[model samples]
Target: MRPVGLALIALAALIPLFWFAPLAASRDPVALFSQYLGTAALIVMGINQFLATRVPGLELVFGPLDRIYVLHKWLGIIAMVGLGLHDIIDADMDGLRGGPLADAAEDIGEVSLYGLLILVLASVITFIPYHLWKWSHRLIGVFFFMGAFHYFFIEKPFANADPLGLYVSAFCILGLVSYVWMSVLRPLAPRGHAYKVASVRHINGLTEVLLEPRGRGLKHVAGQFAFLSVMGGGLTEEHPFTLSAAPRDDRSLRFTIKDLGDYTSRLYRELKVGMEATVSGPYGNFSMPSGRDPQVWIAAGVGITPFLAFAQTLKHRESGPIKLYYCVRERGDIPYVADLQHLAEETGKLELMIVNSLEGVRLTPERIVEDLKGDLRNAHVFFCGPAPLRKTLKNSLVLKGLRASRFHFEEFQMRTGIGLGRLAVWLWDRGIYAIEKRRAEKTQPAE
Candidate 1:
């Protein structure tokens, strides 16, 4: 993420320099810089599409998908700011005011600009239900395609024989294609295998989604996730979930989902055996690194899912002295406790420590540092959990002389909640509790 993000930033910063710097003296400097800003924004938006595509070459090196999301967000913001500056400084309204044709074109451009602003803002708002936002966001394609028309027609270069126009036009075209591929084609894309539901097990308030692949199975490292869109139960949209087990020889995948939203909460009832779904991407870089030092693995709630995959990988490798701190709000929230415990015992050097937050086990970094055999700097610390827990632990550990490089974790933004201010809070809070309903005495075990 660092290298690719920085490169994109650099390119966004440099395009204006390379393209507009030479024309600065010949044209009105203000108008020239305004056009430059618009052009830079267009370039950034083009880059935006590529990043969103989840190309393995880029993501494998540049990101885990979470950081890419944050980066993708910032690029959109930068583009909007640039376009705003362009509109302000290059106000050609006086000319447009005199001509009806010019006025119509100018109005269209204004609409496109504002439309993009709303689209980007909608995405930033965590309160908006992801489903509504996901569908509405598709309208950006219309605005974007029209923007390309606006660009080609209004930019003096393309209509007036400027060579730089070609590149800008190319970017706009590419951006349009990318948006279509992602918004329309991706869900049905053949690269993602079709899977039939093998079983749905509701355990400890979480739904274990086990999928049996219909054809070629997804090849992924442990600790990775994929986007799954079930055809049944009104689940037409693709949602991301982590693979909880190492790739089974039978090629089945498991997702232990806690109801975090409208869709997930009902999945147990709606999704059933023989139902179909599409699986795209084996994304994320949450896997363990090569070296075997005294490793400290920490997990909170459902965040422990990835580490469960990692534990399976440990079976075949030369293992290290590892300590897993699995913390949950309560014991019932724990998923695969027996399996994870078995992995710990089987690994010989790995130990599992279950911390029930309900019972008052505080997982402070200071406590962790003291528990380990050597200096904190020597241990490779990998954490998976809620953002608050990761943040608190990371801050304390880094402050207490742990090398920042030794730490690893993904961003844990709560993104699944549906719609509006305090209502969003109400929905999300209950949505979580609703998923974690205590199982009844009469419920059957996994069949």
Candidate 2:
């Protein structure tokens, strides 16, 4: 997917250079560079919007949800660099540089550029509050429209009767159309049914939220997740959590959320029974395989959420031989093991292994290879853990003769806000987390 994504970006980047090279070379140096900058910026923005659509066809090529987001982040960074260069090189404020026609349009373009810089920055800044970041994220379309207007109206080569103009404008139009459909039309889009909290179970700093649909419910498979919004919780931001149980006819949903940050830590106290919420989605393709291939499943910490869904799913299927290694800091950190044990008994094809790192029984790639032994020959490795751990195993086990395609992993962490930016933003985010955590502590609901 990375190579494929790079190839697509290269195509978008090259269209303008190839199409307008003759004209640009014949123009002023400043003008040439400015046109290059503007074209590159808009092209990459178009690529970003295409990825945002989440079309199943495109996702099939993208492979994983996180990979698409990673591409989105890189495209945003590249577009920002282009916009910055355009602004720096084309800094004539008055109508003196461009014609009287472009003077006002150029200013509008500058305003859009500045707004975009802030929106891209907020995604990585983290401490700005998720809701604020998301709301600002929606402003991308407004600035994108402004940029498109600037491109079309500024009397540049793109405005002329060049294929370059039509080509770039096509992408801009497609991107804006996708944006309107996704961002503007999503709220009005009929997806899944509305849900309300039926119960909340507190367990070892994790909250098991059980929701029942108000009308019809979501049809979700095991190992898939949905975007959850708990209304009346003082925070209306939607967060993704895996469905902890298999699909049942009653349309019930379960999400075991670990208290990882300020937002999650506050969920238990703020959310009440019967609180209205929305569950819109059953996204992800990280379920069991169709073939009769032997499988190796790995789970770490809270990453086991998806695998729990898989386990419940296994109950109804003709289960195959499975080896699952659940790694945790300690035994107490492992949630829902009893359920897994019962699943093992019921399925008779599932084997559970617990690895407690604090007890010095660390889970390593070599250990996995040794344990699987002959089974490792053709077994498909499915990992639902931290990215670093998965990458490490991929490198180590691939050296030990693991097939790259057979090894699959899903990133449970949200990558929407991750991007290339100042290292200080991370520190600032941590500080914001500390302050918010303290505030959450101080404002704990009275028992």
Candidate 3:
């Protein structure tokens, strides 16, 4: 399995070990384990807060920002499970209850657990409105504060100044600081590049936003994305959008956004020229492959944004004979086709293929091999598209003689989950398809 920020996991695991080391000889094993569970869970919660801070260079400890968010979600789930188990076992030491303060701490812990449950539910349930979810998410630190208070004040098997106690206190302070920096200080004093909207255009179902820098701008490679916080026109939330244009000296940026969600719809309808926006990134690891290798570039719908930058950066005709497959619902749905076509014709290196799914044109692995008509042993394949399309094409192409190592793609998703909504439907569909295929083969004449 890929590393889900193993640093955090190791820290959480080790803390419990340290806490349980001296107490291993204690006769009350049940209570000891309960205390262990609570300590581990609280540590995990602290790690989650740090992950959410999105501090620069954190991608080194964690993976990319996208993967960090995914890890954050899972850590939240694990922390909740640990907390629940701790509560179920009733975390209490034998004959060590301090009077009134312990009672209040216990009450505080209960309240924090319930609060976290509601907030985590709000986060995981996809149907919740994004704005409301964001609002609930910001309040998580308050409950974390309560939890830290409980940890300090409650009657425990060890003194507050002991090694484990100091460690937990350190985590609590770090988590709280991270929380305050991200949700409180960052908003009042932004850390991103300042820019003003130079232009805004609506093309078909997409919105192209052009931003000119107000001061020093974000320096980023093509295909990397940045979080945009537009100031006015009912757009208060910050959202990540990929820069569609290549990097330039002037530092102006272009974001080609599709009107798919509430925020994007509002941006498309209400955003005006001259509106101020803050760009909080220069994030993601997605970029063009280096060196001279015959390449296959595939994009679907708005997935074409990153490839637009890729196309713009192709300066030398000798660098590549890159074959670009632009998959669209219809030919008319794209506004950048002419730009790509012009570039291809000028360079004599890039080949543009538009696959219109509305027509009967489907891009399959067979088609790719036929078009190449050569050995695929050293070819690099880069793709950005819907998950289903990526899965189908990646698996099929690998079977059809493409090197698994040569195939490249980025997960690039921010709000991934445990697939609670589509898991059942997907399993059902796969089962039905298999049964029908088997039945059809049985009924057919022997081939």
Q: In model 3, where is the ten-residue run with the lowest total lDDT?
A: 1-10
Backbone clash count for every predicted candidate, in the order shown: 2, 0, 0
What is the model-wide C-alpha lDDT for candidate 3? 0.84
- What are the TM-scores, per candidate, against the unseen true structure? 0.86, 0.83, 0.89
lDDT of each: 0.77, 0.80, 0.84
Write one digit per residue (lDDT tens) for candidate 1, span 1-447: 778666765665565466567765655668777777877787788777767787667675567787787787778888889888988897342222232354465677788899998988888777778779877777877777766666655634223245576667777877888888888787556667788889888877788888998997788888888988888678867778888888888788988887878888768568788899888888887778777678899988888888888888887887678889988877454678898778778878678998887898788877798889447877888998877677788888888877888889976652422234667689999987766654443365766
Candidate 2 vs candidate 3: the lDDT winner is 3
Off by over 4 Å in 2: 1-10, 28-34, 53-58, 87-99, 125-129, 158-162, 177-185, 188-191, 331-333, 416-447
Ranking by lDDT, best first? 3, 2, 1
Where is model 1 poorest over a 10-residue stretch in terms of lDDT? 91-100
Candidate 3 local Cα displacement, residue 48, angstroms: 1.3
Full-model lDDT, candidate 2: 0.80
Could you give candidate 2's per-residue lDDT for residues 1-447 as a string of tens digits? 557767777877887777666764556657676778888899889878878877657756665666677678768988999999887786332222455657678778889899889888887676677657777888998899898888877856445457888888887897798899888786677655689999988877779999998998899888888888887867466777888888878999999888887678789678778898888677777788876677889998888888888888776786568889998886554688999999989988789999888888978888888877756668788898877788898888888878888898876666544544456688899999999999999999989
In model 3, where do residues sit more than 4 Å from their true spots? 1-4, 316-318, 331-333, 372-377, 399-406, 424-447
Evaluated against the true structure, the overall lDDT of model 1 is 0.77
User: Residue 364: error of model 2 in Å?
Assistant: 0.7
TM-score of 1: 0.86
